[model samples]
Target chain A: GEEVAQTPKHLVRGEGQKAKLYCAPIKGHSYVFWYQQVLKNEFKFLISFQNENVFDETGMPKERFSAKCLPNSPCSLEIQATKLEDSAVYFCASSQYYSGNTIYFGEGSWLTVV
Target chain B: AQSVAQPEDQVNVAEGNPLTVKCTYSVSGNPYLFWYVQYPNRGLQFLLKYITGDNLVKGSYGFEAEFNKSQTSFHLKKPSALVSDSALYFCAVSLRTGNEKLTFGTGTRLTIIP
Candidate 1:
């Protein structure tokens, strides 16, 4: 694919339910990133992967949030026991390399926790 | 640590007038600056980026940004504002080495008043 692709454009999940989002990076892109955009429009970096390996997980919430990018599969971000605060737009981005490369973003998956 | 700041929450410009959105950054080493625009209910679109070499870099939709190392700023500019240009603009920065994650500013909502 030429652009980053995200699944389930909109997802409405009840509080305490689980929400899962998927992303497929552009072809040949080795690095994948996930960001959360809240209603305030503040973008919070969640996690990143370098060729299916966890490159950074400091920003991820260890208790309930988890993500994975395995070879030959679309990357996944899963939120367990979702809360109202968890409602946000999840954006998936990708880049060819680590430095000085332009990162392209997907259309984003909207998650609404009711 | 790396961070970006967009001083203004909102900026208004009359159609046909020049427009400027302010941005400042702080990083450990050299900075990789970028500007992105988001229309209502749409994904972010890349505007421009300042990687190295020239201080001024041009990008899509007639947008340009000037990288000022002394001031640690990358301000987005356009010669003339158009009604269609009204959108939310974000400024982001990343380190030239080590981290590949982009730290984005709060974002500036630009309105091109007719």
Candidate 2:
């Protein structure tokens, strides 16, 4: 079975610092997605990419949150000037086409901004 | 806008008994529904999806979901629950073609007692 891969299962950062997370989607998967899950809450969509091109970013916080999927490289999500509220588990998911399809998720990177 | 609602926050069931987790959706057009499971400290795993064809969709780990258009629901069902089945389940939906941004529910924690 194909699987999505994420680096740094846990990250701890101080407030106003920068934090970056990486995700390598399954091979041949064209669509990738980023979501934020805050402690026992529902997941909120942050952004999505289609082969290195951003498909949707309506949920992203433009001021501090940015994500990029460079060609031939794993997708990256960077947060500048982090705040305490940014503490959550970031999930990376990938799917064949992304139309309510079978999306596989990585174990996720837990971010803690204190 | 598309959205998913999980009616129950938790469902406690005994091992070897049938279990069900209810999910409903609101979409502008014909919706595409999906179900995923998440274990503690792990990423979400794909369970099943309902696109078209038959209403009943079988998935991994002996899980199944029924797509009811009239009811606008896609409830996950298991004939015989196991303690290993204790996990969080999420329901999601997409409203239009190429709509990869999924609207997720608050999630339901299923506990199977031995």
Candidate 3:
């Protein structure tokens, strides 16, 4: 089936350790997005990429979080210094177009910072 | 800022009965509303979307949503509920133009009693 793929379904890191999650969008999809879900609550928008170029990142928590979608590699969300609050599920999504009218999601990567 | 609201935290219904999940929004520009369903450990699956035109829009499964501009609501409804429909439902909104990120509301858990 055509679906987005994410790696490290579950990850555990020390409080100060760095954590990185990856996602591969469906083939031919042009836009990719990242979102954070904490305690199974509302999703928080993190960033979006239009074919490797960042489109919007206003909701991103700067200073510790950064993401990129390289030409040949999968998109990655990396936390420079993991914090307890950063323990949550990170989902990656993709859409046929940039408007994200019908974006699809990956299974999500669960990150745990202790 | 674009935002979505799902007032009920959970909704209970019996199989074969009609079901409705409420959602409301606030946006500066025209709104693009969406509904998604999430099973256990899986990522969100697109159910329906309201972009333009008709006030009533049908989507995947047996679900449909009415886009009421005057009421500022896009409520999801299904004629007959199924036990398989039990899951976490989310309502989201995005700018019809420009912004591509989706702002999601706190999810509503739907349980269908068989």
Q: What's the distance in Å from true for residue A29, model 2?
A: 1.0
Cα RMSD to native, each candidate? 1.0, 1.3, 1.4
Interface RMSD of each: 1.6, 1.9, 2.1
Candidate 1: misplaced stretches above 4 Å?
none
Per-residue lDDT tens digits for candidate 3, residues B52-96, read 888999999989999999889999999999999999999999887
fnat, candidate 3?
0.75
Interface quality of candidate 2 as DockQ:
0.72
lDDT tens digits, residues B89-114, model 2? 99988765884677899999999999
Provide the global lDDT of candidate 1 against the true structure. 0.93
Q: lDDT tens digits, residues A10-107, model 1?
A: 99999999999999999999999999999879999999999899998889998999999999999999999999999999999999984588889999
Q: Judged by DockQ, which candidate is best?
A: 2
Model 3 lDDT, residue B3, Cα = 78
The stretch of ten residues in a row with the least summed lDDT in candidate 1 chain B is B94-103
Top-TM-score candidate index: 1
Question: Could you give the candidate ranking by lDDT, starting with the highest?
Answer: 1, 3, 2
Docking class of 2: medium
lDDT-wise, the better of 1 and 3 is: 1
Order the candidates by TM-score, highest first: 1, 2, 3
